[model samples]
Structure formats: structure tokens, C-alpha cells
Target: MLSQPLSKVLGKKTADELIRQGLLTVGDLLHLLPRRYDTWGELTELAQLVEGEHATVQAQVLRSTSRRTRGGRPAALMEATVTDGASTMDIVLFGGAGLMSHYAKQLAPGTTVLLSGKVGLRRGRRQLASPRFQVLDDLSEDEREALLARPLPIYPGTDALPSWKLAIAMRTVVDQLGDEDVPEPLPAEVRAAHRLVDALTAWRWIHCPQDEEQWRAARRRLRYEEAFVLQAALARRRVEHESTHAAVAWSLPGPQSLRADLDAALPFRLTAGQVRVGEEIATALDSTVPMQRLLQGDVGSGKTLVALRAMLQVVGAGGQAALLAPTEVLAAQHRASLEHLLGPLARGGMLDGAVRATRVHLLTGSTPAPRRREVLAALAGGEPSILVGTHALLNESVQLPFLGLVVVDEQHRFGVAQRDALRERGGVTDPQALPGSQERRTPHLLVMTATPIPRTIAMTVFGDLDTAVLDETPGGRSPVATHLVPWEREPWVEGIWRRAAREVATGGRVYVVCPRIDVTDEELTDLAHGSLGVGADEPDTAGLEDLVSALGEDPSPARPLAAVTEWAERLAAEPALEGVGVGTLTGRMSPAEKTAAMEDFASGRTPVLVATTVVEVGVDVPGATMMVILDADRFGLSQLHQLRGRVGRGDRPSLCVAVAGCEVGSPAYHRLKAFAETLDGFALAEADLELRSEGNVLGAAQSGRRSDLDLLRVTRDARVIEQARGEVQAVIARDPGLEHHPDLAAAITERLDEESQAYLERA
Candidate 1:
């Protein structure tokens, strides 16, 4: 049943609907397990039911009615009044007339049924809307007993095919299975060691379990399988990468290299974490193979210093280094930062014609034509230099004749192919070098991300690359005090402006962030859901409890939205912020306007700058020590952490005020509280993983590729991923090309997309 097409089992119309929902194959359907289970073993009286809890109730129908909805949308509502023991409740359903008529039959007066759904208040009266129902008259004694003994699975479905329809299809598929053996990809020894049930049993228990333990066991087995396949693929990629040779491995420095000079010229002492990561990169650059490393650090963790140390080595060895930034703002920031850190060492002493004025150049899409032409000519001339740019570096016209090192900041923003294209430029100087030949001396690659990643995710997604972490911040960095402000409280709402005024009076600047750049709420929903990493891939159908459990609070729907343009205008006119310049910055603004706004805020001319997420990464204004985030609940954990890091760089203590109008019990509420309680990015990152799956962090969400995770969660399955990683390493060691395990190799290939396969080969 798991191997045949769905069209053969379900009708063509149903199959097409499932296909539209991304269920392309029979295996796809099998992997669509329920998000949660519902127990129907016992029935509760209407008076015993608690608000917000889902429960099954047995009651006699007292009244029934069906009527068309007010709007002319061809929809109707079916309602029934039921009484259990002492209290009564209303049952409501929303659908077409056909569905309402169908429910009207089961809800006849004096009918006895078991109804299950969330208990809520509708117009001050208890009600259960769109619940699962079973008519007692149609069930036999044994059938009723079995139904009461087992838990029902609840799946995410649409109106055309509800949860009941999916359950019926699943039952038909299970019945058709009969005694045939299902395909099991894992080896027998592995399954036996883990004490997991066989594939066939796992599938049955996952969809139709008699007890909680059975479904839990089934999930473990499936999760292990998913982790195993992913680790094996990563292992193969690592093996292939290590076996290749590089064309231009730069020589290591002796005692008096420019890298040592740059390190000694730092204005402040290096942190322990920075020194450690810098050494790791230096060692990799000295190796014969082109280095492929990931440099991860929290915001304000001195990642730039480590990258600069690596770039200096390339320049000292008579080669050019290129740094790719995600945005033009960051590219300009990097260029200014490197020039400031380089002191006067970037002058013509290290390499010929490398004057400090010409050594560090910025080349973005907005560069003037004259400057762009001059920069292009200098790059083609083979001068030892450091060029920082955005996507413009990937253009075919730009060339680095002696490129030796490529550093990418916020690597997830650019696809793997774009990074490879820059590295490929290093080898293109020699026209005779073949595309995939070892004679092509590709540049050593170092990718950096300020997004603190959980260890499990780093291993699973970037297993092929060497990892170095910078977790410690340098001395003199003040800790930013965080506070969560509920907009429902009038005092807190009014105090937001007062806080900004006080900060400005102290000669410090502030940052005000909004979810949307424009005045409209057109993308507000997308902004909220996107922050949670739920969109085209993972849909959000979670209930109040799911939200509460993940967010650590109940949700409210009365939260107000913050728009950048509107907030900027409001703050500028506010009497509290008197004589304080308030400026608006957004992606829609011109580059010159953005630069001027940033300059005004940096120079203390503008005490307040209201913007969107454009300033989320690498916009360093140490003088700004106060940040106010409006609609703070709309952001995810990692994003919130990054925004808070914007302050606390100066000698004075900093403060971050998160203003939210979100409901009290919502996931957003919980997330904000959790963020306010801790400043550790790593801890917040782990929580982010549980709240939001590792989709965005893994970069698969951006690539439009299948994450290939059926049941495995990187946050909870760390031990399993480690175990699979070890086993796959041993297997790959014994069979380098996987000749002895063709099935395993084929499975890995099937799991990886073409882009990933190419990325692995290029790296």
C-alpha cells in the first residue's frame, strides 16, 4: 500500500488534491503522521469539561438547526444543543449546505452521540465547534468498546478532505496491506540494536495506535531512520572532500608575517574564543586541501577579527581575498571595519602597490561607475588587496586574478552555488585549468554566521565543513538589560516614549524596529509566520495548547500591529520626544538616504531610528544603547536575540524594551518572555529549534529543496544523530565509494537534491 500510487486507492480527484498539498508519492502519504493523538477512552459530563481543553462528551441532542451564513459565500452553519447529566452545550459546524445537511442527520433531536473538540465560550455560552462525532446507535458493543480503548489520530487537512476523510483513507490503505512485507531501508542489525519495531509495525502503530507507548516507539524508529540517511549522505560528502587536492595552498607564516602584525595591532586584547577560532582557520589555510570551514559566533562575538586574520594571511602570501556580505549596508560596514582595524599596516609595505588608500575597497551594486571601473581594473591587475562586496562579487565581469581566500558573512543568505562561483574565480586565472581538475587552485572558503546554531543542526546540515565557534565576547562589552512591555497596560504603553526620551537626554541613540516597513498590514501575517519558519513547507495548524506548550503561555488575539512608517510619524510628533530627531529607515529607501539616516543616528543627530529587519545583522553603532522593538512577539527567538545584541557595545550599560500587544497565552508571548529571561544566544537557539523546526537554520528552507526530515527533529534527536554519524563514518571508512552497500548509497542519493550534490562536489 505504501508503494502504490494514491490514485489507485483514492479517486483521481482526491489524489490530485493530495498532490497539490505536496504528497507526490505513496511514501509521502505514509510519512504524514498526526501532529498529536486524541484519547477517547472515557466520556466527561458537560459540567466537568474545562475551557481550552479537548475532551469527548456523551450527551443527548435537544435541539438542531441549519441556516445559511450572513455572507453570500455559499456556506452554512449547523448547530445543535446537547445535554449531559446536568449542563448543556452547543455544537457548531461550518461548511457547505451538503456538509450541514449531513451533520443535521446525526444531530437529530433526542440522539445520543460522543463529541470531541476544544471547549470554548461562544457569546458567553459553552460550545464545541466542528468536533469529531460518533453516533451511539450505529455502533455494536464490541466496536464501541474497541473505539473507546484506542486513541484517535488527528491530521492536518483542508475542508474538501477533513480529518475524518483522511482517517478513512488511511484505514483503507492499512486494510489493503494484508500480510505483505513493507520496505525497510535500515539494516537488521541497526534496528535490533536500537530495539525498534520493524517498518511495517512502525507504520501501523504510527497511524493507529492502541496506546501512547506504541506511538512513541514508532516515532523513535522513524526518527532514527531519517537521521541515519542524512548522516550517511554527509559522511560520503566529507570523505569525497578530504580525498581531493587543492592547487594553491598558501604557505604558513614564520615569525614576522603580516598576519602576526595585524594581530598585534588590535586596539584591545583578543578573547579566548576569538584566538581559538583564529588558530583553527590559520591551520586550515596552511593545509594542502582548500579549507571549507564554518565560523559561528553570537552577535558582538568578534567574528570579524578572526576573518580579518585569515584575509591578512592571503594578502601576505601575494594573493587577494574577497569578503561577500548579504547586503550593501553590511558590505560598507565591513570595508570600514577592516580599514579601521588594519591601522596603517594595509599600506604598500606588505605587497607592492598596496597603498592603504587602495588596499581595502568596497564594491557593491551601488558603487559609482568610475569607482567600479577603477576597482575592476585593480582586481584584474593582480594586486594583493581585500575587496568587500555584496552579490556584485558574483557577477561574471568581476575577476580576482590571484584570489586565494573567500569569506562569506551570513552565509545562509547566499546559495551554495554563489559561494562556489566566487571560489571558482580563484582558479579561472589559468585558462587551461579544467573545471573539476585538481590543477585548479580554488580559494580556501570560510563562511561565517552570527546566528548561534545548535550543535546537532550544525552537524546535520554542515557536516562536510570544519566548524569553529566564538562564544566569548571581548572585555568592556556591557550586558544589555531586557524588558518585556505589554501594550495592554496603559502605563507601559505610555512609558515607551518616555524611555526613548530619557535615553536621548543621556546623549545615547535608540533603535525602534517594526515588523513591516510600510504603513499597511499586507504582509503582517507573513511576517509573523515567516519568523516562525512556517510557510510553504510547514503549515501552522496548532491549537491553543500547542501554542501554550511551545510558547509557555496562553495566546490573545487583541494584539496590535506596528508599522514602520506609521510609528516613525507618531514618534516624531510625540511631545515626550521633544527636540529629538526621529528618522525612518527601510529597504524601500535609497542607498544615499539609508546612509544618511545611519550617519545621523551614529553621530547623535537623530536620537531615534525606526526601521525593519534591515538592521538585524552587522550594523554596529556602539553609541546606541537603547532599543525598542514594537510587536516583539512577531519575531522568532534567534531574531530577537540578534536584535537585542545591537546595543550594549559602549561603556555605558544598555537596555532593550520589547513592546508586544500579543495575547497572554500565545506562543509569541511565551517566546518573548523566554527571550527576556536570558541573554545566552546558544540557549535561546536551542529553544528556537524546539519552537521552530531547524528548517531556516539548515538553509533548506531557502533553497527550495526537500528538508527530507519525515519525523526526526534535530533538537530532540541529537543522540540518534550522533550514533548514526559514527556508524556512517565506520561504514564509509570500510567502503569509500559505498560499492559494498549499493542500497545505502542509492538511498542517500535519493535524499539529496541536485543542488546539494553539486555543492558537496564543489566544496
Candidate 2:
């Protein structure tokens, strides 16, 4: 019955309405938990009602009047004065004559009613305009008392179906529900251990609770159930992946290998965190079970170096490794960084190359045809080499027959399918293999993210992968000081340009970050007419939308925001920055343009580079000492931290000035203030989680399809998630296939959709 379509139970019209809200099955409707509970035991005081505020009041109607308007179209107006024992207010309703007649008969004098509407002041008297009211006189004495005693569940509802209507529909369905409808997903022993209620009882109490305690208990049970099913699915994925997948076991490099030679030729010693994480990756690479590891580190923490070393391990063992970046800029940057770091080792076929070296090649969407063919041919040759590229690497034509390791940089930018596609492209089938011999192999995966993930998120989202953290920076890396500047303050705004000029004068580079590439004509018109601020248009990207909404800002009629094009042009002509070369970089720019701009900035020819978040991740300029983020509030805390990380890479002390356009004390402003106060990526990650929703735990941040997580909050449910993880691990340990827990298995299947299941499998 629970699995049956909602239309089978409720009438078709009502069922369709609920289905439109993503509640398809009876079980889905049962899980549509109430947003909150409203109590009728204490009615809102009429005298305390504030104008323009929504209020729900219980009172007795003392007098009533009905009249027809003489104006344009005939309309009926009904007015009634109501009063609690202490004070009185007016309720006004406007509608057709038939509706007014009905309201007049229903709201007769001496009738008790419960009314809800926005309070307004008319002729210096408080009144409710077109209030929704329920006549209490119709209910029996006992029912009236029951209503006053028990709290009413208020669900998240649409305009056509209010909370009260949803409650009625839920009650109708729940009344006919039986034990078989909501089977016990949790085992008896597990329920006893956790002090949780049965599934049926939880569902009943969650929707129609007798008291606050009952509902709280119900919520707790359901929250745990959500976490348990999620964790169980993840555990099962891990079990299946380990058992089914086979990978090349690349051993630790010998003294003369490329990995060892790179380490020996390094200009600086490895940090303790890097050394520890490197060992973790090395161990995973040496396992035939296939490596599934996530390497997360703070900005400037040498994550790239660690990943490079792991890739070299595969190359040294006579297998190819691919580094997948999310953008062409990052891919090209990675290629250049690898070449610079490896020096002669990256030029294996050249005369000046190291004897035991291998080649490093780049393949991007913009790669020239001849060069692209050359890279593809080299990969198909099965010779040990390192290949770096963007999403183009996932193309069908790009194959690595002897691939042993895959390193994905800025892992979150790519979807699960993209990552899996690259992994699936590794190793060819062996037709002559014996029955027990490994028929095919997948490459080991090492995904790196510079954005530190909070503990709960790491467990919930990346639970299938082993995690390694590089928390320390290399020696000689400069410490960055962050400051928040209000955009409304003119002196502070002028100081930004002056500071950039000063940094340029000292031969240090500066990065000026903007939220958008350029302003649109509509925005320019709005600015010229002073009707709306610049960037009044909605954010071009969903990320900015989510950030703005999470910061509690209305994206419509957006505040004035900075743009790379406008800022670059303005700064180039600024008196303070006169003759100080300013360059522009945005994602819309061609690869050559971006590279040239970055090159000029790196060489100090263009001391100031104005760009968008395109340089958020892997752009390294050691000489850059200052970063100015215009409209910093438009960016997420993690993203702002990443942008700030572009500087302070060298021995010079760095500073990051975040210019906030949000009002002082707003959520976005506080977020920027927090970013300015701390350089700790982990702490900022937690702050980021608090300020924003955790999004879809199963997939990409904003993928709404798999975001069925209504009860389990990754931010505030740390203990619950941890407990669920432990319980799941123990259960999976006892029953590898969950064969003994059919109900739990069913629950897992019900909770995870096809996309979510696929995500977990690929994750």
C-alpha cells in the first residue's frame, strides 16, 4: 500500500496536486514532514497585533455588516468586529455578492472563530483583510477542546493547497494505513539499541503528534532512518567496488625512477602533511583493489605536488597516468607547472632529458589537430607518460590502454559520470586470460580539492573514498592577512586601488577579482537611468544564485556588482594606477588570451590582472602579493578563500581585501567578515556549510533530482551521521549483502533513485 501511487488512495485531483510537489507515492507523501507546528492553545492577542504582520487569532464576532459597492463592477464588502476577552480587532472580506452572503451567514454575531491574515491599519484601527477563518461553533465541544490542546502540523505547501489542506489529505491517507504499509526498516535490536520508535509509529506521530515530545521523537527516528539508509548505500557501494574492480598495483618507485628523481630534484623539502598524504596515496596505488582516494588540502598546501608524485609513481611502473582538470586554463597551467617542476625529466625524448624520465603531454579541447593526434598516438602506444587535459580527456577517442592512475584536480567541478568515464577508459580487455586472471582493470583514482570539506560533508558525500588531508604549507610560503572593506565607504574603495598601485610599485603582482565577466546592456541602462544598480540582472551562473540566496539576498533587482571588463578598463585609467599595466582575464576569453594575460602578470609586465573566478583554483603566481575581491559577498566563503589563496604563494607577506556590497550585519557581510578573520580552510568550510544548504549530498551541489534529503541535515546532524555510519559499517560487516535485513535493504532501494545509486557507484 505504501508503494502504491498516491492516486490509488487519494482522489485524482488531490493526488495530482501532491504529485506536483514531488510526492508521488503514498510513502513519499507520508515522508513529507511538516515544516513546523502551530498551536491553538494560546490564541494571538488582538491588542498585540502589529500592522503589516501576519497573525492568527481566535475570537468571538460581536457585530457584522455587509454592503454592496456603488463603483465600477458590483462588489460585496463584509466587515465584522471580533474580540478576545482582552481586546478587539476588525476582519474585512471583499468578494462577490454570493461569497459575501455566505461569509455573513457563517460569521454571525456571537460566533467563535479562528482567523489568519496580515494585519493592517485602516482609519487608525487594526483589521484583517480577507482573512481565512474557521468557524469553531460547528465543532463539537470535545473536538473544540482537542483543537485547543493539540498542536496543528503545518506542512510546506503550495498556494493552491495550503498547509491545512495538506494536513487533511495526510490524515485521510494515514487513517487507512496499516502495519504492512510502513514496514519496519530498522531491526528490532537496532531500534532497542537506539531507543527509536517503529516506522509506523514514527510516521503517525510525525504527521499527527499528540504533543511536542512525540513529534520530536518521531523526527529523531526518521532522521536516523534517513542517515542509516544513505550510509548503508554508501557502504554497499564500497563493498561492491572493492570486490568487483581490479587495478594495476603500481609499486613504490625505486631510487632511479621518475617519482624518486622528482622528489630528489625538488627545490624545497616536503611538508609533514604532504609526506603523510603521499604515503597514503602510495599505499592505495600499490593495491590491486583500485585506489579511491580524496586528497583535500588548504590553499597553497601542495596538493598538486602530491598528486603529481602519485601520477609519477604510475609512470615509473611502466603505465600511463592522466590528470583531468575542469578547465583548459587549469589544464594548461598544470602542464606548464609539471614541465617547470620536472625540468629535463618531462622532456624524455630530448637530448637534455634525464635518463629515466617520461614525457608529459597536454590535451585540451583547443589542442591543435596535429598536436592532438600526437598526444592520442602517444597514449595509444601504451608507453609510460603523464597526460594532462580538460574534459576533452574523457572523449571516446582518448584512450590509455596501460593507464594505472587517474588524478582529478578540483574534483567537485566535474560530475561523477565524467570521472567514471575516464576511469572506464583505462586498461584493455585481455581475450587470452585464464578464468581467474583479471580480464580487465580500471585505473586507480586520486581526486584532489583545494576547498576543504567539512567533516560531516566529507563523510556523507565522499564516504566511498578514502580521505587524505594536507593541512600544512611548504616552507617559504607567505602568510596572508585578510580584511573586509565596505563598498559604500569611498575612502576604503579608493584605498583598494591605491594599495594595488603600491603593490605594483614594489614589484609585487595584484589580482582584482570580479563576480561577472562584463556588464550587459540592460544593466548599463539601469545604471545610467539610476533605476536599478549595475548587475541588476540575475546572476549568469547557478552557483552565484545559490550563494546569493543562501546569503538571504534577493537576486532579482540585484545590487551593484563588479565586472572584470569594467574594472579592468576603469583601473587602467585610474590616476593611482596610471602607467601600471592592468590586464583582463575571464572565462569567455580565448585560451591564448588568458594565457598571455597570465603570462604578462607573472612576468610583472601587467602588474594587475583583473579576472573572474576562472583563476579561483590552480593559478599560481608567487610574485602576486595582494588580492582585491570586488563584491566579495557574491561569492561563497569557500570560493572567496580560494580566490584569496591565489596570492601569498611566495616569501612576501600578502593581503586580501574583500569589498562587500551587502549591508552591514547581513548574512553575506558576516560571511565575508568571517572569511577575513580566518585563514583556516577547515574552519571556513564549516562556516560555509552553516551559511548555505548542503545541497544534494548524493551528487553535484545543486542537482535537485537526487536531493530527497528532507530530514537529514549535513550541517547540524554530525552526531547522527556518525552514529549512522558506524551502525551501517557494523551491519555491513555482519551481513556483507544485507541479506539478513530485507526491510533495511528495501529502505535503501526506496531512498536511492537511479541517479543517486549511479552516483554512489561511481563515487
Location of the lowest summed lDDT over 10 successive residues in candidate 1: 537-546
Note the Cα lDDT for every prediction shown: 0.75, 0.79
TM-score of each: 0.77, 0.86
Task: Compute the lDDT for candidate 1.
Answer: 0.75
Candidate 1 local lDDT, 294-413, one digit each (tens): 887878889999999898887777778999886667787899898888868765645433233237888877788899999998877767789998778888888776778899987745
lDDT of 2 by residue, 299-379 (tens): 888888999899899888788889988777778889999999999899888899999888999988778899989889877
Pairs of residues clashing in candidate 2: none
**Error at 150, model 1, angstroms:** 3.8
Candidate 1 clashes between residue pairs 3 or more apart in a chain or in different chains: 553-665, 554-664, 554-665, 554-666, 555-665, 555-666, 556-663, 559-661
Best by lDDT: 2
As for model 2, its CA RMSD to the true structure in angstroms is 5.4
Considering every candidate listed, which one attains the maximal TM-score?
Answer: 2
| 416 Cα displacement, candidate 1 (Å) | 4.6
Alpha-carbon runs more than 4 Å astray in model 2: 11-13, 20-22, 41-146, 254-256, 428-438, 452-462, 517-561, 588-590, 665-667, 700-706
